[model samples]
Every structure is written in C-alpha cells, then in structure tokens.
Target chain A: MSGEMYIPTYQDMLDAHERIKPYIRETPVRTSAYLNELSGAELFFKCENFQEPGAFKVRGASNAVFGLDEEQAKKGVATHSSGNHASCLSYAAMKRGIPCNVVMPRTAPQAKKDTVKRYGGNITECDPSTSSREETFAKVQAETGGDFVHPYNDPRVIAGQGTCAREFMEQTGGLDMVVAPIGGGGMISGTCLTLSHQAPETQIIAAEPEQADDAYRSFKAGHIIADDAPKTIADGLLVPLKDLTWHFVSNHVTDILTASEEEIIDAMKLTWKHLRIVMEASSSVPLATILKNKDRFAGKRVGIIITGGNVDLDKLPWLK
Target chain B: MSGEMYIPTYQDMLDAHERIKPYIRETPVRTSAYLNELSGAELFFKCENFQEPGAFKVRGASNAVFGLDEEQAKKGVATHSSGNHASCLSYAAMKRGIPCNVVMPRTAPQAKKDTVKRYGGNITECDPSTSSREETFAKVQAETGGDFVHPYNDPRVIAGQGTCAREFMEQTGGLDMVVAPIGGGGMISGTCLTLSHQAPETQIIAAEPEQADDAYRSFKAGHIIADDAPKTIADGLLVPLKDLTWHFVSNHVTDILTASEEEIIDAMKLTWKHLRIVMEASSSVPLATILKNKDRFAGKRVGIIITGGNVDLDKLPWLK
Candidate 1:
C-alpha cells in the first residue's frame, strides 16, 4: 500500500461516507453567538468531538475497517498514534469484530490509553520520539501480520476524513472558508479533498501551533517539512505531514496559520466557558488563528472543524 | 398578578411554545453509550444547557417578555435570581429591545453577574438571604415599575418551562420517566404540567440535593417547607417551592429523590468526562439520583433534563 502514493479523489470520499455512515455519527453543528460576535464572523462548529469515540478520526477509522475485503479482514488492522486515532481505529475494529493493534507513545495521556484499552485495542508502547514510534510500529506490524493503517497518510483514511466536509457543507449550506487544525494533515487534507469538488469557491485554511509549525513551514516553503519531536500542549498535532496529505495541503489549502501556545489555551478555555463543550487543545488552534486574524475572517461564514474532545480531565493544561 | 394563585394549563403551555419559538432554541437531545451501559437505562439528555443564555429559563423568560402588551412592554420585566434566571431574563428582554431589571444577591458567582450585564440587564445587588433578596427586590420593583417574573413560581414562567417537556416527548417519541433537579420546583412543576397532559403515563421524578432538600421534605410533609438559607454545592436548588409549583408537585410528581453533595459532584465530573459537555453542577442532580436508584430506571427509557451550563470555569467544584 505504501510503494506508490495514490491521491484520494472526490468519488473515493463520497463512497467512504456511505461505507462509514452506519459506524460514525454525523455529529451536530453548534454555534456560539458570543464567539461569532467576538470574531466578527458567522461561525459554525461541526462538533466531531461529540462522536461516540469523541473524535472525527472515527469517520476515517471506520471507513478503513469496514472497507476491508473479507479476506483482508482476517489480518485485522494496526496503527501508531499519540491519542484519538489509536482509540478511534480500535473502536471501528471492535465494531467489525476484528483485532486491532496499536503502537502508542509511552507518554500518551492515561485517559487516551484507557479509551484505547476500553475499545479492546492491544497496546504496544514505544518511546515518545518519532523515530522510536516508527521503529516500534514496524516490528509490531511484522509480528502481528496486521494491515497497516497509517494515522493520516493513507488514502483510505484521508478519503474517510473528507466525509466531515461533506456533512459540514450540507449542514451550513455554504461557507466562505473552512478552518481545521493540521497535525499530520489528515483532517485538513480531507477538508480540501471534499471542498475542492463540492465547494471549490470555499477557501481552506490550516491552523498549526507555533511551537510545532512543520505544516505551516511546509506551506510557506512550497515543500514538505518533517519535525522529529516538536513540543506543544496540543499533543494530537505534533506529527509531520506525509506525501499523501501533502498532496491536498499543497494544492487546495489557501493559507496556513500558526497560533501561540498561550493563545490556543485561552481559546480552549473560552470555548468551554461560552460554547459549553469540552474539546482538545489541538481543536482550539483554529479558533486562536481566527481570533488573531479577525480581518481575514470577519463578515464571512466560517466553518471550524472541532477535531476531538478526548482530554485528561485531571491534567488540563490551564490547571497547571 | 400575585393576588390569587393562577394555575397554568396545558393550553397555556402550547401557547407559550409558539410565543417563544422564534427566541428560544429547540436544543438537541444527546445520548452517551458509555452512560447507557453503566446505568442499564436508555437515557436521553434534553440539553437545555445549550440554550443561548446557557439555561432552560430562556424559554420562560422569552415567553414572559414577548407576551407583554404595548404598555406592559414599555415597563419591561424584572426578576430576582441567584444566577441563571437573571441572565436569561436579561437576554430575553434585550432581544425584544426592552429594559430588564435584575435583583441578584451580591454573592452570586461573578460569571453569572457578568452574563446578566452582558445582556444589558440593570442589576440591583441584594444580600444573599432570601428575605433580603425579596425586600430589596420589592423596593427596586416599586421604583422601576417593572413587571415581576418569579424564577420558578409564576404561572407564565411555568407555562414557558412546560414547552421543554413538549419538545422532549417529541424528540424521544416517549420515555418511561423524566428526571429534573428540584430548585424552586419551576422545572419539575413544568415537567409535571406538560407530561400530565401530553404523556400521563410517564412518571415525573424530581431530584434534590440532600443538603437543601426542602422540596423533598415538602413532598413528604404535604406542605411547603421553606429553608431560609440551605448550603449545598448545587447552588441552583436552594430555593423553596412556591404555591404554583407546589400545586403540580403535590398532584403529579411520582417521587422526590435526594443525592449527597459528593455524589452530585461525581456525576457532574463524570458527565463532563464522558458526555463532553460543560454543564452546571445543578444539572448533575438528575444523573446522581438515577445512578443511586439504578433498579428504578434500569431497562427503561429515561429523559434527563440538563438544566443549565452557566458555571465559573475558574472554580470548577471538582477541582476545588
């Protein structure tokens, strides 16, 4: 599956949406008058956080697991993720009655690990570094003889992620622009994939934490950039963009923006206070960028994809 | 308006629904599979907390504000509340381009006061005690000539709150029982008012904090039990039931259950962690009682009213 990179087309996304519909929630879209007033934009939040697995990655994970042919289903699926993707994949696999193996950083939040285990995913821990994660994942895949489902790089996963944009477009009618946090670029790439076909006039923006700005740097430099172990409180977004995600990011994303750690935390707390929903810090990057760049978004109908809500309640960033 | 006790009828509730339709949100009902598995009950959460003013009170507040005649509308509306009602009333009045006067205990959470002010409500501070609040409110009302809208006791307000149950029944098709926290008994009374007419077979259960269980005592003693100042982490349920609310509680309520402060806090955090919604501790009482009396709700369809989401994020009860 990794030899030659295949870009997921709009048809693949449409098919993925139909395949994953039974397994995923077409989560509700939420709006905050306070946030709209503050940003001077009509903001619509596609609440993927409210998904049963508490993340949008479930859309992609379910697509990958259910799309498996009967023969390939016997091998099950495997992936390495710092948080949501691992648990989401396990959830999808469990629903399909297939074994799921996850290689996770030892330092991943205990809450995340608990969720993965709850979904019956077998966990093999690796060091927190990227090199250690890749090396450990390779060994696990070989030993388990599992089908590798890369967290964000696989065409199946990206196509699955694109389903969110399809729902967002239907729910909001149309939007001037869509903003999403870019980690490994799975969500953003998916947004680009669907919107490029369905709402070509709509601009796509990728938000990144300044502390881990590989995606933002790549967009500006006109090439892919890899960050080994960038540090940020938005743990879900530390990975570098791969070739498949880069294909969409490079072509369809109109802009890449970065926000400070402090701004991201502030935006997160503000959402919890006003929007009244618990969401991860990584999801806050888009709001932080919008707040910082109000003129760019003001008076426009904006769609912000809230990626996930799986946070360790005891270890909230602001509490420290 | 206070001379003879007026009972709100089912027709009044139907009328209130139409009056408030443009101003209030028909909040979505949320379900948690994890919670359903734990309680052995199919629980449907009518998320009133997602209301724009962050409370179910907006339904009643909007009804009262919009039902006014031209001369009465000029006078505007007033209410004395410890928290949510003050802000909600202010929000409703602001929408109609009318004045909203609020009599609030100076001791109310600053977050609540800020919300009231943000909605352009004129606030008159009073002492924390019930007597002081009423005394101050009388003077303020006399001076301003504002129409008094009781937090939970008025027929107009009860009729307005009844609309929630109407939507709940429509949303869930039907439920075996409906549970809500008993504060001034406004919400519970409203539930009884609607269900007695719409779905008479559905049981109405009221949950109360044991520390401030005046409603529970009142239910047992067959009379009103007023507690001047009761202490509990659930600040919303401290008020005693008034005559209009007492009428419904005595006739229609199946039971009044109480939960310990610790149990309420635990349920609040559990909902936050699993349901991923920011809600007030007051809203957790229903879940607390449901957990304690699992056998009563087991295998039955239960509707839980999430009363409000106006909390001081800086001082979450569990964190303290």
Candidate 2:
C-alpha cells in the first residue's frame, strides 16, 4: 500500500517536466565515443550535473517551491540543506522574488553556503548534531511563517525530480538500464517510477555510497533504514532514508549497489580527465557502481545520470 | 590571386557533415540561462569543446583519415602540429587501424604529446619554427610512405572541420549571429561556408587572439597574412593563416575581433565555473570577444563555437 504511493505513471513525469520546464534545465546528454567502444555498449550521460544551481536537486526544489499554494508560497519556503537543495531552493524562490530561508548544519562546506547566499537565501546555522538543525529550522519557520520544503519524501518533490527521467527519455528515447546515485532516494525513486512506467523493460539500479548504506539496507528490508554514523567523501549522500522514498524504492527498484569513496573519487577524476566536466564524489557514485558491476551490464544500452557538479576546486584532494 | 585560392563552397560543407556523420559526434549545444538574462540576448554554445579527442580538430581529422582513397588510406597518415590537430589526427588514424606519425614542435606541451602517444601516433620532435617542423614531417612521410594530413590547408580537412557548423545548423537552425575562434582559420572557414548556405541570414564573426592576429590582418589586407613571431595563450591558435582557409574566410567572414590574453583567461575561468566545462584558451576565444564587444551583440541570438578542452591542468596558471 505504501509502495503504490510512489510509483508514478509515465504521464505524471511528463506533466512534471512541463511544470518545472520554466525553472529547471533540460540538461544535455553527452556521449563518450571512446567509452562506448571500450564497453561495447551505447552510453548516454544525462548531464543533470549542469542543471541550475549545479545539480538535479534544483528540479525537485523548483517543483516543490512552485507547487506551494499562493498562501504557502507567500510565506516563503524553508529547507534543511547546506548543499545543492539549499542553493536550488534559494535560486528558484529568488526567480519568483520570494524570500528563502535555509537551515544549514554549521559544519556544512563554505562553498555551498556561499551558493545559497548568492541566490538570496537567508541562512541559519545550526549544530551538526541531529536534533540541532531541525530545532533551529523549526524556530526559523515559526518566526518567518515559511512553508517547509522537504528535500524529498513529499509527492511534489519526487514528481519534480521525475522530470529528469522524462527529459532523459525524450533525449535518448529508451535505455536498457538507468543508473543513478541514491542518497535518501529522491532521485532513484523518481527514476524507478518513471522508468517502470515509460520503459518497463528497462532496469533501474541504485548506486549508494558504501559508508552510507542505508538505502541498500532499506531495499533489502522493505523499510526505512537510518544510519547514525556515516563516513564518506560523498558529502551529498550522508543523509539517511525516509519513509516515503523507501516506499517507492522498495517496490519499483531492481537492486542497490555500493561503491567505496575511493572508487567514487576515481570515477570523479576520470570524468574530469576524459569528459572535461567537474563531477562531485556523490555524482560519481553511478560510475563507481558500473565499474564494480561491469559484467552485469555487458552490451546493454545504459543511461548514467550525473546528479551534481558543486565541487570545490580549491580543496579537491585528488587534484594534488 | 593567392587569396582567391582559399575560398570554400557551401555545398562542400553540407556534404562533409553527411559524409562524416557516422564517425564523428554532433556534440551538444548548451544555452546559458544566466548569460541570456545578463546580456538580454539568447546565447547558444556549440560545445565542440567536448568533441572526441577534446576539440573540433577531430571533425577535420576524422574526415581526412576516412576520406582517403583505398591506396592513400593504406599508406597511413602524418602531420605536424603543436596543438589539438596532432592528437586529433593520431586518434583518427589509430581508430581506423592505420599507422599515424606526427612531427610536433619541441615546445609543444608534454600533455599534448601524451595524448598523441595514447592514440598510438609516432612523434618526431623538431624546433618550433614552421620550416623545421615541415622538413621533419616531410622526411617522416617520405620514409614511412604516409600521407601528410595538413592541419588546416587541405580542402578535405577544411570541409571536415565544417561538420561542426553542420551540427550547429541542425541544433539551432536560425541565429542572428554565429561566432567562432580563428587559428589557422580552419574552424571558422568551415563555419562561414556552411552557414552562408544553410542559414544565409546569419552573420559570422571570427574571434582571434590579439597576439596572433594573422587572420585579422589577412581579412583587412585582402590576402593571407603570416604571423611574424606571434605569441598567445591559445596554443591551438599559434599557427599563421594557411592559404586554403584564407580564401573561404575572406569571402564569407563578416569581421574579426581580437582579445587580450587576460580576457581569454578570464573567459576560461567563467566557463569552468558556470558551465562546469574545462575549456582551454582557444575555446574561450569567442566568449572573450563577446565580453569585449558586448554593445554590438545586444538583443541578438548569438551562437558561439567552443572549439576544444584538451588543456593541461598542471601548466594552467589558474592551477598555480
């Protein structure tokens, strides 16, 4: 019953793409001729990494922000993120000239916070400990009368993220497999739902960080799994699973694959070297999964969604 | 009379894109929403910067290698370069299973040489002077019975490079202006000729480096102008104007604009930061021109061709 709540129809994705088209980019699809030959598979990279605010989160954020009723939208939008979503929400709301509030863990990277600031978001820093951020966000929302914008879990948010799959389908038509990184399952949930309806024959693989294996665990247990401690360079993926996302992922997903941080970093470097585009560690998760499970996808037409590109070039350790 | 020898026909470009379609990438077209808002003009980037072998040279190289007759193809290929052309030729020939030799200047960056090596091209280094590199390449061609693949002079090569324009015409059919970076004039020649026929209403602009203003001088003097010990940060644009490219450029090119090296560097950084693509100095030339001549292009639909991205990170001043 819970699973059915998240399995959206292909038509739903199409409508969502149309709704968010004004706010989000129909990011280009890049092909690697060399990689295609080497892998003996036709590969299409849906470069959501180049989306507005530099990640696919903009799709979900913009959709969620726009979905808010005039009464709710007038109060402005609030979200807990010092990452892509924070920047995305700020940018989307700024486009509407609406005030935005972001509750960021104090430990969040400076680059991400700077991004949010540039887009006119009011920032409230909170302790990194679990309870502090939510508590601070609640206080901020109470004072500002802001509507809460969940990063994922909400139907409107997942529907917004689903636009990526819709564009992928339009650009490359169909694929034998669709692979995307799984954090709290926003991207994967949208992808699995969209693929199951649009390209039923296509398999959906969720690539997760090994250190943050909550999504993988949730997939196996058919319930939400929360990890208290997570360590990985994929900072975008440290968040634990949510009940709504778990509902979609458990029913429509194929299987979850995990990649070590080192593998993710290597993939990120390879993308930079060969593709000539910046890719963050979390964005490289799908490529890492592909590297780990090479045999599972031989000769199949594969689509890889590069989810984000908010990398700090000045501090990238691997560059040295 | 010498200038008349370089003119290219519109029909040749249309045919070239068709002939080279299977072997080359159309490359994606990117529209920067922020730039559009900033300039009050819609802008499209033809990112040949992401082309195979990291630049638009591959379009020419692939055409030259594949256009060879049975006997010529069997003889293999050779060329002399200090930039994108060398790696592109080597890569094209290697993909066709033909032996390739490149006579590169000793001053050419090591990273470029490594790209040639990875594609299995035999390299013979000579001094940076044109005559010396030509002599070395001649000797290698004579000894190895290889066909010489001139970087930009040959009709086939010019026609091949024109394929990039073909794809641009396909992606963005109507444009008020089309701009391209000028080096040996190959890329712009192809573009001008193609757009002249395919999109006759479009105005064409050539953006060249101030230090290496051979193409600009040629356009002004109505003849091919050779660089006299010119210097510029755009390594791909080091060469003086070749005779064949001069004719095509002269007849169709509207005007040429030159930019300072600092402007080019700034453009490079902006492209990387905003677009997330690491474009080299040559690829940044059009953007540099746009920045310099902002008043001229206001409220117009402008298309810029980003020529390549095979830059060495270690040698980059920004990295330092």
Candidate 3:
C-alpha cells in the first residue's frame, strides 16, 4: 500500500543538504581496479558506510531531526524500525539533545536493538506484526507527544535522502548511470529525485534481490507492488514500496534488475576482497546486478551507492 | 648479520615520491570519531590497504621496477618475499611489462603464491631458511639475469617506502606524531626518513608485536638485535632488520613500542569495526601501541600507517 505524502522538491533537497551538512560525513568515493576489470565498467562507490551512524540512513535521519522547530523538537521524534534507520534516528535525535522512541518487533536481532539503545533510543517492543507495530507506535507517540517520522514514505526523509545523490554528483562531477538497492524505495526515490532534476541524462538503475523482487514486478506492471515478509540475506530491503517512493521509482527509474541470493553474497564477499571495505549484503545488490548485466554498464562510468555497513560480525554469511 | 649499504638522503625520498606517483595510489587518509575518542587523540589512518596491489609495499616495488635503466629493465627484477612485497613487485613488474621472479619459501601460504602468479610473477620455492632462501634467490637471479630487489633491506626499497609518509604529511597537512609497524624496519625506516626530513617537528614512533619485539630490544640496547624465528600473528612483521634499515630506525625513531598479541588482534578487530575497512594484523600495531601508551599520545594529531590488507580470508584470526 503506497502511503500518500507531498512530493519533496529540488529546493527541499537543497535545504536538507544545507541543514545536514554539519552533522554528517562527506563520505569518500572509492574505486577498485580489480572490480573494474571484473565488470568491465569504471565504478565509483559512494561509501555511506563511513557515516558516523554507519549508514546513509543518518543523512535522512539527521535532516528530519534537525528540521524540526524548537517546539516540535522538544516533543522529539518517534518511528517504528528494526534496522539502520532506528539506530540512525536515535543517533540524530541524541545529537540534537532530543528524545527518540523506536517501536521494534521483539524478535529483532539483539545487535540491532543494542545499536538503537547505544544511541539513547527508548525501545517499545511489539509482536512481529504490522498491526502490533502500528498499535504500539501510536500509543508511544501519544504518550510522548512525539512526531512520527516514517522511514521512507515521509517527504522530509525522502528529501533528506536526496542529498546523497546530490553529493555523489558533486564528488564525481557526473556519471553515465547510478545504481542503488531498492528497499522501501527511500534511497532509490532520493536518487531519482536528485538525478532527474540535476542530471537527467544520467540513468537510474534499481537493484533487488530475486527472493524479494516485488520492485521488479511493480516496475513492469507500472504500479507499486510490495511483499510483506520476503526473506533474503539483505534484511534491510525487506520492506515494500510506498506511494511517496513509487512516485519517483515508476517515473525516473531506468530499470529494476534482480540477482539470486548466492550471487548477492558472492558480490558482497568480492566487494570486501577487492574494495578492502566492509559492507552489508543489501549494499552488494547493485554490484551483483552490475556483474550479471555487464552489457548494460560495460565501458560506462557508473556510480554505486554503498548504502550501509551494519552486518553482525559474528553472523557474516561467508563464515556460516 | 646486518649488511652495510649507502644511506638514502632526503632527496631520494622526494625522487621516489615523484617516480611512483602514477604507478601507485595516493591512498586516502581516514578518521573515525569513535577511534579518536577511544585513544583520546585525533587519529588519521593513511590507508595503504587501498593500494592497487593491496599494500604500501607497492610504493617501493613500483620504484624499484620503474627505476631500472633500459638494459637493466630488460633483465627484469627478482626478490625473495612470502608476503605483500612479492605480490606488489609482481604487480609493478606486470604494469611495466617486465619479467618478475619471486623466490618464496616452500612453506609460504598458498594464497600469497597465487597472488604472485596472478600478477604474472615466476615463482621459485626455496626451503624456509635464511641460507637456503638467499642461496636459492642468488641462483634464480643468476639464471634469469634479473636485478636483485631486496624486500626491505635495499636502499631503493627504503627510499620508495618513505613516499607514504611524505604523502601523509601533504594529505593531512602535518601531524604531531607518526606511527608504523616495524618488521625488517622497512615501513618504519621510511616513516623516519620522510618525517625527519619534511616534518622534523613530528615524532616518529615504531610499533612492533611483542612476540616479535627484536626492534624494541634493539632500540633499548642501542644496537641491532636480530630475531631468528620469532612467531606472531602479524606475519608481515617477522623479518629482522638489516644495516640499511637499522640506520634510519636507530637514528631517527623517537621511540619503539611493543603490543601484546591479544592487544594487536583486538585493535585490528576494532579498526575493522570502526574504520569499516580491511587491514592486515601488522597494520593494527600502531593502534594497539596508542591504546597502550595513551598518556604519551593524548590530544595529539597522530598519523597511523595501515601498511597492508593482504590476509588469508579463510584463516581470519577471529574466526578461529
């Protein structure tokens, strides 16, 4: 179900960029000769994994937390998340000296919960169900009188995410194509928003896991199609497309490509080996897609967003 | 056992920097707030792990390969190394389209041998003993008529390595202290050479694994103390210092520090956790020493040389 929200403008993204510049890192873009030889494409990786909270989610989270007026900020912000967004929001809120409440499923990994708690987030656990999460979140927000910050569907969050691509363009000058993993479509929508306005000649490519290929189907059907509980190693991309994200994804996206779980993990390991950097499985989807579809990207200067680096060290898939 | 050689001057380092600029990566200097807070100092990691051949060794190897005269170049280059130097020399030679002969120990890790072969180096395995290795290397050089390029002992290699610290100074402006792991004293000697000439006000600190603390003992004894077979997880730092390396180490180093095996591994894991980059166990010695000697480094801007990222993935220490 696509949630209805005001479409963020180019000016909104610019404002978000200015607002969040001080709090976030201007993460470096890295390249690897071995990776280029493998794909036959010159690739530049925008390493958001180097962000303080260890993910690009901090960009949007910081923008949302900082954009709140003094009165609203005092009430603080709340969200229902069990991933990087939860930790990033808590980190941003803590930095702003405001309270943050997160509604997480009780079954969420302890490592995820610990990260949120480490950032001073107050956790309110619900059963692993959408109804339970919504009911618990509503009560928590009511008790705290906090503003709800939807992870991807909110205009402010999407606008905040848009700044990443803006920075990418400035850093690399320009790229022939930009690729990013599509989860709830926050990062992808942000890419579309920025590139469509700033660099329309640059194509936007969304990568998805085969097990959770709703975005691919949705693109083909010309509408939003989302899976509720698709299981994949890319845990961050389990969420489906919402209307705010769908608006950008359907219109601006060049294509949605898919890769098998094995391919995704292989790409993740290869990235760790060649890039000499740690990145999560979800972030590897773009590389997986690029390797699988070399004809499309070969000889092109491609920019890939390494969305995050929040994998549980003990549970690295290769180790298993 | 130390062999005498002409000491390289400051101009040698400058020449090396200019010579290897195109062949090597001017790897980025990265910082982490968490790491800085832990050490109570601002730390800049000069990431040589990002080098094309995955180590700072490429700096020296490229210089040696490219500095050869037309006739000497036709003869090619040869060295006996079981670590980063072997692969780096091969990579540099491959780039220059010259024959590279690496005389590796028969007991050297298969992964290392594979890397040398991947770069088109002819591998000649010798018995894992000093006399055996040297004799084998001599025979190989005689048969191939290749110019000898010692891993760390040669003045050419030392001059080449000094380029890393020179770049670090230019990249970070200047630092109060510079730290690097000391094995055969190649990287540390280079650091001392560059910092002493360019940033004379900066202190040069040498870090060594306690299990292989010959350099530490040598500093205190005021004479080179060679270690025959000291064992350490930092495999890259097992080589003993020769007269050429000893000259720089003894003359310019501010202090030599040693870290326990446990401490080195912990720092390595912590770096990977915070810096979000892969680095070898040898590279983590600087951070380990900083953590141990916080009083000396507190509040200072310190540059740490992450010497390499060449680790056997299947045998990651933490996994064991």
Which digits, one per residue and each the tens of the lDDT, describe model 3 over residues A75-175?
Answer: 99999999999999999999999999999999999988998998899999999998999899999999998888889988889999999999999999999
lDDT of 1 by residue, B35-116 (tens): 9998999999999999998999998898899999989899899888867889999999999999999998888777778889
Which regions of candidate 3 fall more than 4 Å away from where they truly are?
Answer: A1-4, B1-4
Best by lDDT: 1
Residue B107 C-alpha lDDT in model 3: 97
Candidates by TM-score, descending order: 1, 3, 2
Please tell me how candidate 3 rates in CAPRI terms.
medium
Give a tens-digit lDDT track for model 3, residues B14-82. Answer: 899899898999899999888988999999999999997899999989989999999989889999989
Cα TM-score of candidate 1: 0.98
A45-120 in candidate 2: lDDT tens per residue? 8888788578998887887777777888888999888788889999999987788999998888887888899899
Candidate 1 lDDT (Cα, whole model)?
0.92
Winner on lDDT between 1 and 3 is 1
What is the DockQ for all candidates, taken in turn?
A: 0.80, 0.49, 0.70
Compose the digit string of candidate 2's lDDT tens values, residues B1-320: 35456455666666667767776777888876766666667788888878778889888888888877888888899888877888989888987989898898888778888989989999999997769977887799899999877888887788888878777877887789988899888888788768777777889999999999988888999988788788888878877776677777888888899999898888887777777887788888888888778888888889999898877655664565
Best-to-worst ranking by DockQ: 1, 3, 2
Model 1 per-residue lDDT at B315? 78
